[model samples]
Target: MPASTPRPVGASGPELHDHLTCVAAPATWLSPPDGRLAGGPGGLYVADRRVLSRLVVTLDGAEPEPRDAETLGADRVRFTAARGALAVERVRTVRHDGGTERITMRNDGDGIATVTFEVTAAADLAQISDVKAGDPPPPETPLRDGAVLTGPDGYEVRLEGRTEAALVLAPGDRFTTTLTVRAAPPPVPGFRPAPPDGPPPWARTPLTVRSADPRLDALVAQGVADLGALLLADEGDLYCAAGSPWYLTLFGRDALWAARLALPLGHEPAAGTLRTLARHQGTGHDPVTEEEPGKIPHELRPAYAPGRLPPVYYGSVDATALFVVTLAEAWHWGMPAEEVEALLPAAERALAWLGTFEEFVSYRGSAERLPNQGWKDSSDGIQHLDGTCATPPIALSEVQAYAYQAAMLGADLLEAYGRDGDRHRSWARGLAARFRARFWLEEGYPAIALDGTGAPVDGLASNAGHLLGTGLLDRDEEARVARRLGELNSGWGLRTLTAEAAGYDPLSYHRGSVWPHDTAIAMLGLSRTGHREQAAELARGLIAVAPAFGHRLPELFGGQARRDGAAPVPYPPACRPQAWSAAVSPALVTVLFGLHRDATTGQVSATPLPGFGPMTVTGVRAGGRTLTFTTEDGAPASD
Candidate 1:
């Protein structure tokens, strides 16, 4: 077996773990773990541009030796370091338009200390895509006036404080100064941040969890905080930006899944995400950007490099279907009828897009587009049992499931709202039948996908787990899938691919890593299909590993099995505050309780799983009111 290595999405992007990230939507700051913005993707970025590339501090020309660092919140971090007899503390805070750092130096030695405190800063004005591709432009000297740095194209960074202060401190005395770095960049056309005065979209109706396991509580709290930090506003509505550092932008599939998983929190985020995506829904055929009428975009970037993706790319085959699914799910979670009706046209359009696909929904690759269009969309994401990459015109198994659910849900929404839905229901039936006949393998489990020639790719993968709750499979079929999923478990969580498969690299992006969102999705499906034992087992795995990663799950991790004494290995390039990954925390609460809301009645229900002990969840929103659920020793939950 090859040793696990970090593979960046870009051809030569730097790994992510080397730096600590602080984010406030459009503005993000990445620096060394010690909070110094040295080189290599460490900078203060605003709207997809690296406005400040380097910021380092020194005392008497000697840098402090970093002693400890702590993340206080998604947008704040604190670092402690020492040089000689002087102890240094730096508190960094990130905001949407700028950032701030408060530095304090204290003399611990008996004698007084005198030192020259110098701050060095520079800006590269480089595109984030170029930075991710490991081709950042050389730093440009910014015209300095006092503590501020000004660059070309309306780029300005104000470092407000004494930059070169001579400090004389007596024993036990402290010297403190605050450096506020504010940026003013040329406005990119499409992106915006939520109003600073308003609370985060998720915080409007908060969901709190308490369980017998402290780890579960900690995971939920941390995950919710991370999700709050990733929220971005588009056309006055809020949606979760995909993740920190690299992906602090709108991603259609990622945002949709995050909102859907977090439905337990409230209907606000779902409503916001649906409206935002609908506002950008595809309107014409354009091969360059892959835009087709009614197609939901793959990603929304302020700008992209030449020969790369366009600003509003519509290459995703699943986001369109997911849009309908999320809207319907949100409606079930007590979204107001007026709100649902307002978006009905967009949902209808998305359903029409689904109808354009023949037989089963599938995607064909292009030179300028992604080869695979599903969530596991890496170049080599889809492969055969023999490790050969699946060719395009590929029909992924999970995508078919998403399409089926979307069709059925769209039909339900249409009929409820007095619109004709016969065609949608008919379409869903045909899709389910085709999927059953063509996508299943002789080995008792569904294949990962069907290739260009309509042959089953025959890779035992986590994709099949998605089928369990989608209603495309029968009860027995769902049971078989739930059983097969157990084979993919790495003790910590479900692996993307089974270990017996040929291309099962534990650290590969989508080949064998454990994605928290993926595992949580499987857990939800298992619980829905009456496979409570399997769901509980996977839930326990996630809770057990939460403490190791500080109760904040990353985008993905090594799929290595958990050992009695060893912790789960980190996938170095994984995004820590990824939206979908963070949403897994709320998804866990939903799965453990087998929670659901009835669309017509506006009633919420729960069937808590056994062996989870006592658990209580408060502020769960349904029918426009807050409800609290408590279950003791696996008993039935009451609201």
Candidate 2:
């Protein structure tokens, strides 16, 4: 079906945010408290589809209750609201304030009399359903007896809804529309639970439905699921965009890498991701359009933009390489070889991108693309001590390795699973051979990457750590890279740009900070290269930080070297327990155990590292069959 056109506005309501959004991205239904979207208080009211005007509510604060109708519950409660009567009062009050609300309540107030209630709408709802539409509403639904409210930024108006004898609330992001005289009615559909259209796809990942502490689990599940929901699935290329609010669209490189870790569990969540992305593989380099032949597109359009949408930009050069990398890796983790083989054309195109997009590499060829490609492609993303960004086509290392590794590994899968024989193997060998000859530096570890003019950046960075992964290096090179990366690894994790670099700033969002996901990547790399000691230490460090700031790890964190007791503080306004970040523990678990699946044999083996504790995963299904494992000492002798 074709997409819905945005509704226009100018009829009712107060000032609203920019209603601009990408048509293909997930639709955000509410006034997103975060900043990923571009509307709200933008001087124009009622331009967006849905508007949250003022929802004024009054509560009964007479004798039996204190002025603070909602008192703190006992038993070391976290909420500031009391139990029983008071709690009911608070829910009712808050619901009234929530427009289009559905709440359950019981009234104990004075017997039916005239009760005055206020429901204000200084503006209008273009769609009434959400913020995506940019249309106007019908004149008959005007608030304040057919009068409109206009003010600075937007408008302001007061209106009234009748207080019926009893009220039944709906259960969605819907507003509260009634007042209760006798008692509150049953919940109507879609009233309290905010619409699910905007949350991430994995927001539905299930934990044990029956838990020891159902209440605690419910809250944890919400946080955990919400954390996953924040993973923006780009439908234009429905790959997971990393995290919510900010990371609200498809990113080719990120989605591929993320799914490499995510797809091991099941096909449902990652399937849409794989199929959609493969559809846009590049064909050839057209510099003006930044299109490279057979190249996979990056940054699927965000649907919630009021302006400034990042459409399916084809600027990213690395995702193509990583795309091949993920497809091959998934095969071992139980991904169907047939499914991956179907995307061979995309892989072919991705490999083609690495060679043709040379001019777009980052300064020093840091595996970066365009001045604003790759994950770190933000305008001011690359920096040194002076906050100066590197020029485009930076080639800061890593890309060559990814290119070679993706080729070799992808070929191995084709030869092994798809029965392509020697030709695939031959292509893989050629790429690896070229990578070793051109990109390697015997003395300065690896020369990071070539600058825009192809100059060497000899900075010691964590970039090589990415090599510890993908089975890219020979044993000796792996050992050397691990030792070099260790120098930049702080106790918490590996720093991105490295402390010894000219632009290293732990506080830099991507430049110097330690992201749990990044660390997880390095941690896996360490284990792969036999750096078990370092891998375990890194794994322990990450798990320790999970509960420190609400058990909600973000995409990345400030890696500022220890200043005082607090260390580098969290980047302001970062989403908590980000999607891939939440995958940290599970992926870290893989690192500690050396979990490998032999698909043809349908067996999963764990060569447990020394520190990994014993655990049991029951009723799990995998290996093209059902099996139970009681693991101990890192070995899962099947049950």
Q: Tell me the tens digit of each residue's lDDT in model 2 across 4-46.
A: 3222122122222211111111222222222111234211112
Q: Rate the local accuracy (lDDT) of all candidates.
A: 0.84, 0.48
Candidate 1, lDDT over the whole model? 0.84
TM per model?
Answer: 0.95, 0.69
Where model 2 places Cα greater than 4 Å from the true spot, the runs are 1-238, 284-289, 302-310, 355-370, 383-388, 417-444, 561-568, 618-623, 626-628, 633-639
> Taking the tens digit of each residue's C-alpha lDDT, what string does model 1 give over 577-625?
7999999988998988878888767788898988988999987877677
TM-score of 2: 0.69
What's model 2's overall lDDT? 0.48
